[model samples]
Target: MTSEVTIRSIQAADTYPLRHAVLWPQESIDYVKLNQDEQGHHYGAFCNGKLVSVISLFIDGNVARFRKFATRPDCQGQGIGSQLLRRVLEEAREKGAQRIWCDARAVNENFYRAFGLEPEGNRFYRGTIPYVRMAKSL
Candidate 1:
């Protein structure tokens, strides 16, 4: 595995394919209806030019709302997601975000906890998929 991982802004071409690999087939996101430009800030982790992980941030007032954080299944546990997360947070802070937030899958709550995110709101369902809204002060 190449350890030359890179995090950078997402191109539109990367959005659809990654959305399928990450969010589709789970009855969660309606990827076919998504418009990346209107959605949020998108970032990707590239290993030797291959996209292995992806995350997004949407700025609203003093907060940066995270969206569609995903690492390719083959890349999980190798810190690709962590790299993506850290870069997103750094970008958020640079943009003057006072807080950062995301709605995480219940099963992956521990991952967010590692970054200091805590459940700060009620659970929400997107087609029966459970998510907990988490927030962290930046």
Candidate 2:
């Protein structure tokens, strides 16, 4: 079923809770906080007035990198994350980003591929989980 979701720019701190809950529940909350968060554009998807998904965009020169993208387990498969990502990509392009990329978890490679991001370089592991660098031109 589809839900009424709103995607909006939010402060970096606002993403911590959701990011920790969905992306790194087994690790300390601090583990989900990125050092470069303050230099990025943060967006959250609110469904039924509750924050259900979030993504962060960091731009350096013409390249925009998004990290810490996550959706609450119960909210996964509802398209909230996809909507937030599309909005972020559009905003990045509007801001003159020539390329957008992320180190996507191996399992999520197909998801990013759906949005035109292709795997680049060899796969690496963050802890024991595998990841691949993915990118696409804006």
Candidate 3:
């Protein structure tokens, strides 16, 4: 894949395939859809004209939460997700969010920490998968 990545706002529907492929392959496609999708802001990262990463941000009051962050398996470790994350974090700050968080998969806690988000509370599970709430003040 080319190293050139473009990050931009996208419709929530555009995030489903990647969300399903990378985050919930065993679930039905409908399981990947968020009920409040129309109320959130979605973004995608494209490399060489192919979508490679996706994240959704929901801002409420002074808080913002990002969800369903995923990168194509083949595109992992290429920094594309990093760029997309930076974009949404910046977007959150610009939109007046004072704190941003996510229910990050436990295995990726270190990855989120590298971006300055700290784990909060005890670890929890969604189905059989473990997760932790990570957050940072913007």
Candidate 4:
């Protein structure tokens, strides 16, 4: 079935449940909470009125970084995450952000590459999960 999906700014609290569900199910919900959340702009994708995808953008002058991006497991491969990323990128550019970056899970490198985000350093591990620093010029 087709559902209407809308992307919009959201409060930090709105992202915690989905982040915990999709990105850190084995850990407590607090595992998904970031100290910088209060200083960032959060965005969510709502599908048929339910929040299904979330991303946070933290800006520092002309540079911006996104963290804790996650989409519900059932919603993966449906392009909802990509739509949310694109919207945030546009918003960042409009706000005069010159660079946007993220520490992306290594497994998802190709997905970020499709959006022009290039890896800048060697892979690193956060606990047991591998990640790479990826960035794009806005």
Best by TM-score: 3
Q: After TM-score superposition, what is the CA distance of residue 54 in candidate 3 from its true location, in Å?
A: 0.4
For all candidates, what are the clash counts? 0, 0, 0, 0
**lDDT at position 127, candidate 2:** 92
For residues 110-136, write the lDDT of model 4, one tens digit per residue: 999999999998999989999999999
lDDT (C-alpha) at residue 78 in model 3? 80
Taking all chains together, each candidate's TM-score versus the true structure is: 0.88, 0.97, 0.98, 0.97
Clashing pairs in 1: none
Model 2 TM-score (2 dp): 0.97
After TM-score superposition, what is the CA distance of residue 1 in candidate 4 from its true location, in Å? 7.1
| Candidate 4 deviant stretches above 4 angstroms | none
Q: Cα deviation of 18 in candidate 1 (Å)?
A: 1.4
Off by over 4 Å in 1: 26-36
lDDT at residue 59 of model 1 (Cα atoms) = 88
For candidate 4, the per-residue lDDT at 88 reads 91
* Model 3 lDDT-worst window of ten: 1-10
Error of 3 at 64 (Å): 0.2
What TM-score should be assigned to candidate 4?
A: 0.97
CA error at residue 122 for candidate 4, angstroms: 0.5
RMSD of each: 2.3, 0.8, 0.9, 0.9
